[model samples]
Target: MSLFTEAFMTALLVGAIAAGIPLLLAGLGEQLSEKAGVLNIGIEGMMLSGAYFGFLIAWKTDSALLGFLGGIGGGMIVAALMALLCVRLGLNQIVIGIALTLGAEGATALLHHVQFSQSYPRLSAPMVFSIPGLSQIPVLGTAFFSREPIVYLSLALVGVFAYLYRRTYWGIALQAAGDKPAALDSAGVNVMLIRSGAVLLTGGLVGLGGAFMAIVGAGIFVPFMTSGQGFIGIVLAMLARGQPIWVLGGAILFGACLSLTTALQVAGVDIPTDVIQMLPFAAVMLVLVFLGRKANLPSALGAAYVRGAR
Candidate 1:
């Protein structure tokens, strides 16, 4: 069999998207959170919650839409904790974030043990849409033109967020909340509200990513299934600076690297499993470090905003 057969190549491309979309969503959400001056380390927990709840809802309701809603709800639940402690009460963001993540992990694990241990269920294939003419073309068609609707939506979000950042009042408020909360306050804008909103939005987006993972990527929810993808998403967000387009690029590239790792293994390359697995993270960091060194982050990216304190 030829290595470059249509089926094999298409599988690689499909795997790349499946692997990357979750990162894309999480990275974008993280970028937004950082823009609002909150480093949300609890996002890993948020993703796990989304995955479990999303899978459960999809399994019970037999509706992908409901699954996504459940995921969004799960993410928001954790986000509220972050907002309450960090944004509203002016606590240590890092400590609160870590606590939230640990709590989510234990909670999800316990819930999974109680509910899904005996009957581990899986979903059928999600709906795949093909662009009428583009899907008829050769290799590129299968890779991109023919994909699940979520793939297209994920790509579209890059453009949507780009527009939001460049030309929107809410986006400006978020920037001001991160860069100059005092000035935003002087201008009568509610910094806390802005930060809280950004965190909630981050949770929703990350939750959607988790749902995508369970319902489309893996078709099942297992404990600790997120596997540090949320942390990787943080790395991607930092590397991309504030550019949604960069996040999209970084996600796709990372996914491609993952596919490469699998391909190397399939081709029987004699490499250590540990080293081979590190390829995706290593390659992404190295490439983004060189390419995104010019990133200028917000001034108060991790500082709490205290009103009227000089």
Candidate 2:
């Protein structure tokens, strides 16, 4: 079989889209939290929680929609704790975030061991939604236009988030909370409320990303399956500098790199497996090294807001 056959290319592009969706979701969620002045380092935990619960629910109920909802709920549960400890109680955001991630890792691993250790089960292929005319446009059509419903929703969210940030009152409030919480508070806007809401919403989005990974990307849940995608999402968000479109671009780039690795492996490239696996991360880091200096972050990011305390 030719290495670059139409079928092969199509499969590669499809894989890239599948991989990119989770990162896109994660980056978008992280952007929201960062805009609201919360670092939200515990996003990894939220994603993991979402993956486990999402897969479990989908497996048991056989409903992808319910599974996605369950995933959102699982992530929100962790986000609630982060909000309480870091945002509400004025604790160390980084410390709390790290703790939450470690806790989630252990908890999910234990649960998987207890429940799924006997027999590893997988989910069926998710339902797809193909655009009528567009789906017939050769390889690119199927790669881009025909996909799971969640893919379209995830892509649409980029535009939705961009609109909210650029032309809305809530967007201004979120920016104010991150940039100058005291000013927002004095202006009668509840800074804590804004930040807390951002964190919770972030969890839901990231959780959905996790659910996508288990139910669609991998078709099964495994311990620590996120593999630092949350952290990469953070990088994408920070480099994006509050631009949702940039986040989408970065996610697609990383996803393409991931697909390239798979393609190389399939072509029997004589390279170490570790090196192949490192392509996506290495590509992101290279971009970060080049562009990170230009990133403009929020002034009060990661700082807990205290009323009247300069």
The candidate scoring highest on TM-score is: 2
Candidate 1 C-alpha lDDT tens digits along 196-270:
999999999998899999999899999999989999899889888899998988888778666765655555555
lDDT of 2 by residue, 1-310 (tens): 5678776677678778988999999999999999999998999999999999999999999999999999999899899999999899999999999999999999999999999988889999899999999999887898899999999999999999999999999999999999999999989998889999999999999999999999999999999999999988998898798999999998987887777667566665566757756887787678778865767889999899998787
- What C-alpha lDDT, on a 0 to 100 scale, does residue 103 get in candidate 1? 92
> lDDT of candidate 1 vs native?
0.88
Each prediction's Cα lDDT score? Answer: 0.88, 0.90
Model 2: residues with Cα > 4 Å off, grouped in runs: 1-4, 265-270, 288-292
